[model samples]
Target chain A: MHSFKAVFKRELKGYFATPIAYVFLVIFLFFAGYLTFRDGFYEIRQADMRAFFSNLPLLFVFMVPSTAMRLWAEERKSGSIEILLTLPVTIPQAVIGKFIAAWCFLGIALVLTFPVPLVVCYLGDPDEGLIISGYIGSFLLAGGFLAVGTFFSALSKNQVISFILSVVACGILVYAGMPTTLDYLSNILPAPAVSVIENMSIQMHFHSLLKGVIEFRDIAYFFILIIGWIAACSIILDERKAS
Target chain B: MISVKELRRTFGPIVAVDDISFDVAKGEVLGFLGPNGAGKTTAMRMLACFLAPDSGTATVCGHDIIAEPVAVRESIGYLAENAPAYGEMTVAGFLNFICDARRIAGKAKKEALDRIVPMCAVGSVYHQTIDTLSKGYRRRVGLAQALIHDPDVLILDEPTDGLDPNQKHEVRLLINKMAKDKCIIVSTHILEEVEEVCTRTIIIASGKILVDSTPALLKEKYHCSLDEVFRKVTRTKKSA
Candidate 1:
């Protein structure tokens, strides 16, 4: 736990130490607001957070991966990974510590969007419960994508490659649960297989929580996905250190 | 104290650290002389618990590296080549983070920093970002980091690789000052470093031990200077 706090503090501070935090914050807030107001038609529609919740998966497709791609890739490139692992910290502790730091940074960025919800409350009567659920769901989804990003970052030493690969991998997960994508799969495959594919998509689980219904299954799905990816990341790190 | 028995490591078809064994006791500086890619770094990595060997076992401070890697890591301070550090961090900040990682905190952490900063002559650059510091200062910060915990074993891989002659002499002096109570391993291609600071020297080639003896004994046996002995030994292994 002590080692975890040490790593977490440094990694979190690292984000703000460079221009990465500012760049990420500006890009995240700009696109999130633009996508919600433009596509969801915030002015033209009812005063609900549906637009904000619906756009989160797409926004995270780009933002969360950027946050995670640097976790290990930068260390490897600069040769600091050797220093990190050789410390009294274990590989799993380092992985978890970094993951928490990135996750918390994303959480902070998400909180910065509080003005959107405040505006919704000002405009008209909206489902407060739904908005809160949407925030929880969005945070979970961000974690899922960050885990995928962390895994790919550990797999590659190049940050650009790590970013591109994570974006593509997360894209597929988000793409898998789209209604149109499921419709297309249904025509070629059997009903059970299509359902399985639909069930596996990150968007499907995320959408369930956005409905203001905090189901145990939905939360478990994200936890399982995040833990699975982080485990793979730890394995990759250990293997790379050995070979 | 450190001991290795039949240690071996391979990278797919290439053997980076072939079967080799040696022991290093306290109060001795073992100069690891080897050509590039001759498994010097790999062996140090194994002893430092950064890399695990494929076959054989090594113990540091009486703890098995494989069985008690975290304990092994706790007892050794390893400085890799080029002295890598976070570019954006100040020397003090980096050392503080290392102290935190080493699980030292509060007053003890401050004391550790206080002891090493002046010992390494890094006080001037305590506030400057590491990227902005010169190469010699960066190496000093790296050395300072390794000495922060004052571990029983010190594994420095090319501690003075790209320094000027005066900087190299300064580093040698630092090593000499710390040589009495620690098992120090300084891997270098420079033969002069062996004579200057190392009490014993082990020359390796092709991932194998070419010679392991005291500097004076190695000179007497080869009937030549340490530089010529290094060239001849490494050259013969390359051709063989």
Candidate 2:
């Protein structure tokens, strides 16, 4: 618990001490604001926040990786990993704490886009439940992408390599369920395999959450993937130590 | 407080640290003397439990390094080379981060913060971002972080690797002062430092221990001074 607190605090300080946090905020909000409001003539139809929520999953694909790529990769590249590995804390605690910190930072960036929903409410009687559900979905989708980035950050020592790997891994997760891709594979692959692939797609899970149905199954899916990838990360570090 | 036996490490077919062993007593300073690629850093990493031994086991404060890493880490303080702090943190912020990661908190953390700030001369650059600090200041920050928790054992790889003369002198003096209660294992290519501060010294070459003895004894055994002793031990050819 103490180590976790320390790690979390340190991560937060890392953000505020550098311009990465501010730069991310500006770029994220610029895109989100532009997408939601569109120049000066705001014409986002529907009571639901489909415009705000759907773009979030896609935005996280690039933005979250840029934020998380340096977390572990930079430490390894510059050799601070030796210092960290020899610390009193365990690997799992370090991994979990850092992961949570990045996720929380993503949450903060998500919150800065609140004006979009407020504008929607100002424009008309927006469905409050739909906006809230969209937020839940967006949060999970961001968490999922950040987990993938963390796993890649553990694999490579260079930030550029980690970034490239993270983007590719996240890209696969978001598109694995598309009908075009599934159709291309269905002819050669078995039906059950395609079904399994569809179930694992992050896009499918977020779509359900966006509808204001925070089902346990979707939550469980994101949590399981996060735990599984982080477990893989620890295993890699453990194997490196063993050898 | 430290022990090793026939420790070896191999990457594929090449041996990096071969069959080396030594012991370091509490409050004693042992200088790891070696040239580049002589397994000095590898041996230190193994001692610190950052890497595993392929064929042998070692212990820190009587706990097996391979079997009890958390215990070994708890007992050891290490300053790795390159002074690798998060570039996005200030000096004080980085030290605080290290303190937290090491689980030093409350009164203990305050005491450490007070003691190490001056000991490392990090006050002038307390809030300066680490990414902007000069190499010498960065090195001091690294030392501060390593000493924040005040562990019983210390492993420093190249303490004066990139420091100016004044910085080097200060760091050496600090190590001498800090040696009162802690066992220190330091690797340095500078042979003069061994005579100045270390009670015992060992020379390694090509992943093998070439000589291990007190500086005076080693000088007498080779019938030469410390510089000559270093040259003789590091000679590429081995004695039959």
Candidate 3:
């Protein structure tokens, strides 16, 4: 528990110490403001948060990778990873704490964009359920992407390699649910396998919540994948015990 | 406070630390003397519970390195050659994080902070980011982190590697002061440091322990100073 808090604090401070926090805030807020005010107004015919939420997963597909790719990669590069692993903490404790700290920072960046939907609510009678569901969906999608990034971060020592690997890996995860890609894949692959792959897509479940239905099954998908990926990360790191 | 039996480690085809055994009682200052890549770091890593040995076992304060790593880590403080620290953190913040991680809680945490901050001479740069601080200060912060937990054993891998003369003197004095109640095993290439800070010195060559003796004995046997003893022990001279 003490090591968890220490890791959590150190990681949170790391994000703030660099330009990482500002870059994330600016990128996330710009998309939300532009999508909700300028883009959504033209497409949805009303001041709704549909566009803001729709754009979130796509943004997080890139943003979350950028945020999480550095978590372990930087530590490994700087050689501090040895110091961290040697501390009186279990591998799971360190992994979960660092994961939550990064995810929570993403949460803050997500929250900063809330004013976009708040403006929509002020100007019209938007469905609070739908907006809340959209936030939940985006958060889960972000978590899934972060999970993939965490795995790739541990796979490589170089941050660039980790970032590239995570981006590509997460890109495939997000792409699996895209209609055009699935349509193309369906034509070539068997239907059952494609269906199974589509079901595993991070975007589809994320989309379910955008429509205001936060089902247990969809939530479970995110949890399983996130837990599995983080477990894989710990296993890989544990196998490479340096002491 | 520290004991190892037939410890060995091999990295693929390369033997890093081969078949080594030694023990240090409480309040013993053992200087692990070796050249670069002489298995000093590898042995220290095993003792620090950061790496598992390929064979044999080590116990610190009755806790096995493999079975009770958390207990072993809790009982020991370690400093690698580079003095590892998060460059983004402030000196005080980093120490606080380490202190917190080491479970120095409540008033005891504050007491540790108060003691370590100045004893490390890091009070003036408490708020300075670790990257911005000088190398000597960074090393001190590393020392401070190691001392923060107040463990019974300290494993310092090249503690004074990057310090000015004054800083080195101060660190040597600090180590001597702390050695009264704790077992401090320091690994270094500088033999004179062992003379100043350590009571017993062990030299390893090519992953094997070649010598373990007090400084005076080592000097008398070599018929020269500590530096010559280090050269004779570590020098890979071929018979000509």
Candidate 4:
């Protein structure tokens, strides 16, 4: 636990020590606002945060990978990984510590979008439960994507490759559950296979929570996805270190 | 205390650390001498628990490197080759991070930092980002980090690789000063370092130990300088 805090603090401070944190925050906020308002937030004629929350899965598919790409790849590239892993910290502690720090950073980014909900409340009477659930779902979605990005970051020593791989992986997860993709898959594949792929998509669970109904199954899906990917990351790093 | 038993590791078809074995008790400064790509760094890395051996296992401070890596790590300070650190972090920040990872905190953390910062001569660059510091200063910062926890064993790979002559002398002095109570393993091709600081010398070539003896005895056996002794043993190993 002590070691976890050490890694978490170092990684969080690392994000702010460079320009990456500020640049990411600005761009993320700009896009969140742009995508929210660009889709005619006011024109939708709903005083809820549906537009803001709806755009997050795709937005996080791109943004979370950028934040997570350097988590391990940069350490390997700079040779600091040797020093880091050699410390008393265990592999799981280091992986989860970094994952949570990046998750928290994304959480902060999600919080920055609070103004959208505030403005919704200002404009008209909005469903407060829906807004809260949307934020919860968004945070979980970012963690899900960040976990995949962290795994890819450990898989490759080059940050660009890690970023690209993460983007592709996260993109598939987001797009797999789209109506168009599921419809296309249902025509060729069997019902069970199509549902399996649909169930695996991050958008499905996120959309469930966005309905203001935070079901246990949806939350479990996100938790399982994040934990499974982070575990894979730890295994990859351990294997890489061994050979 | 450190012990190795036929420790072997390979990269695919090539053996990086062959079936080699040696041990260093506390208060012994073991100089690991070998040519480039001679498995010095690989052997040291295995001892540091950064890499696992393919066949055999080693133990540090009564903990096996493979079965008890975290325990082994907790008792050793490792300075990797080229002294890698977070470039964007200031010297102070980097050391503090190491302290934090080592579980040093509160008054203990402050005392550890206070002792290591000046000992490694990184006080002048404490506030500067590691990337902005000179090579000598960065190396010192890496040294400071390794020493922060005050572990029983020190695994330093090429500790003087980037230092000036004066800095090198100071580091040698530091090693000599600390050689009385800790088990130290210093890997370098610099023969003078072995003579100046190491109490015992192990020369390996092609992932195998060719000669393990004191510097004075190795020189006397070869009837020449330590440099000539290193060349003769390593060259003989290559030709044979």
Residue lDDT tens for model 1, B1-240: 999999999989989888999999999999998988899999998898888899999999999999999999999999988888999988888999999999888999989988999889999999999999999999999999899999989999999988889989999998998899899999998889899999999988778998999999989988999999888888888888
DockQ of 3: 0.76
Q: Pick out the ten consecutive residues of candidate 4 chain A with the lowest summed lDDT.
A: A234-243
Ranking by lDDT: 4, 1, 3, 2
Off by over 4 Å in 3: A36-38, A240-243, B236-240
lDDT for each residue of candidate 2 in B124-151, tens digit (9 for 90 to 100): 9999988899989988998888788888
Tens digit of lDDT per residue, candidate 4, span A1-243? 999999999999999999999999999999999999999999989899888889988888899999999999998889999989899998999999999999999988888887898899899999999999999999999999999999999999989999999999999999999999999999999999999999999888999999999999999999999999999999999888533
- lDDT score, candidate 3, position B194: 90
| Better model by TM-score: candidate 1 vs candidate 2 | 1
lDDT of 3 at A242: 53
Whole-model lDDT per candidate: 0.92, 0.83, 0.85, 0.92
lDDT per residue for candidate 1 within A1-243, as digits (tens), equals: 888999999999999989999999999999999988887555667988888779888889988989999999988889888888889999999999999999999999999999999998898888989988999999999999999999999999989999999999999999999999999999999999999999999988898998889999999999999999999999999888533
**Pairs of residues at least 3 apart in sequence or in different chains that clash in candidate 4:** none
* DockQ of model 2 vs. true complex: 0.65
TM-score of each: 0.98, 0.94, 0.96, 0.99
Please identify which of the two predictions, 3 or 4, would achieve the higher TM-score against the true structure. Answer: 4
Off by over 4 Å in 2: A37-44, A238-243, B236-240
Q: Please give the TM-score of chain B in predicted model 1.
A: 0.98
Interface RMSD per candidate = 1.3, 2.2, 1.3, 1.2
Sorted into a CAPRI-style docking class, model 1 comes out as medium
